[model samples]
Target: MSGILRFLLSGLAVLLTSYLLNGVHVRDYWYALLVAAVLSLANVIVRPVLIFFTIPITFITLGLFLLVINALIILLVDFLVPGFNVDGFWWALAFSLILAIFNSLFDDITGEKAKRNQD
Candidate 1:
């Protein structure tokens, strides 16, 4: 139940982020949901591998490289999902940052983070 709520919130975040960013385009609410699911899967499956491989660079950049990895994940989602488009790497980066902010805000509002910490 919580997982489903989280998924819906994530989709909302995607839609809102794309609406705010001129360079990011989401075809509709359904596409936003699809993007959210694909993005979550990429973060779960691909992010760790990317972090492991880029440890040296991540360290050298004082963790800033994680942002690049996040942008790359956005690009990967753009490629895999139809009706979702990011203008370029810069746009993808902006989209990622904004989406993260929205997700964080949603989590806080829903007390999801508090529940997670208790668990």
Candidate 2:
């Protein structure tokens, strides 16, 4: 299904991000998959709530606060998942940015955009 494909793509993105960033560590592809799943779930459940509560600050910062929220989610996943580690706050922030970039690129390369048109 498309969802499964998206999940795998996200895992690949995580692996790619870890490879490019010095302070981010993913033990293996399995851990990358797990990290991707957790991040997806957190984005669905936790991120919206955090964003809702931080709307004022998010607006005040001209949307920059979302980056901090993304870093916090990365740190949360680091705590909840084993074998995936982000070195520090700065590294986590960097990791989030890189992961986002990689995920977008992977989605585009894998025909996900074309699939979206059909849906």
Top-scoring candidate (TM-score): 1
Clashes of each: 0, 0
Give the distance in Å from residue 49's predicted Cα in candidate 2 to where it truly belongs. 0.8
- What is each predicted model's overall lDDT from 0 to 1? 0.97, 0.94
TM-score versus the correct structure, for each prediction: 0.98, 0.93
- When summed lDDT is taken over every stretch of 10 residues in candidate 1, the lowest stretch is 1-10
Q: Model 2: what TM-score?
A: 0.93
Residues 21-95 of candidate 2 have per-residue lDDT tens digits of 999999999999999999989999999999999999999999999999999999999999998999999999999
Question: lDDT of model 1 at residue 81?
Answer: 99
Q: Which tens-of-lDDT digit does each residue in 4-106 have in candidate 1?
A: 9999999999999999999999999999999999999999999999999999999999999999999999999999999999999999999999999999999
List ranges where model 2 is wrong by over 4 Å: 117-119
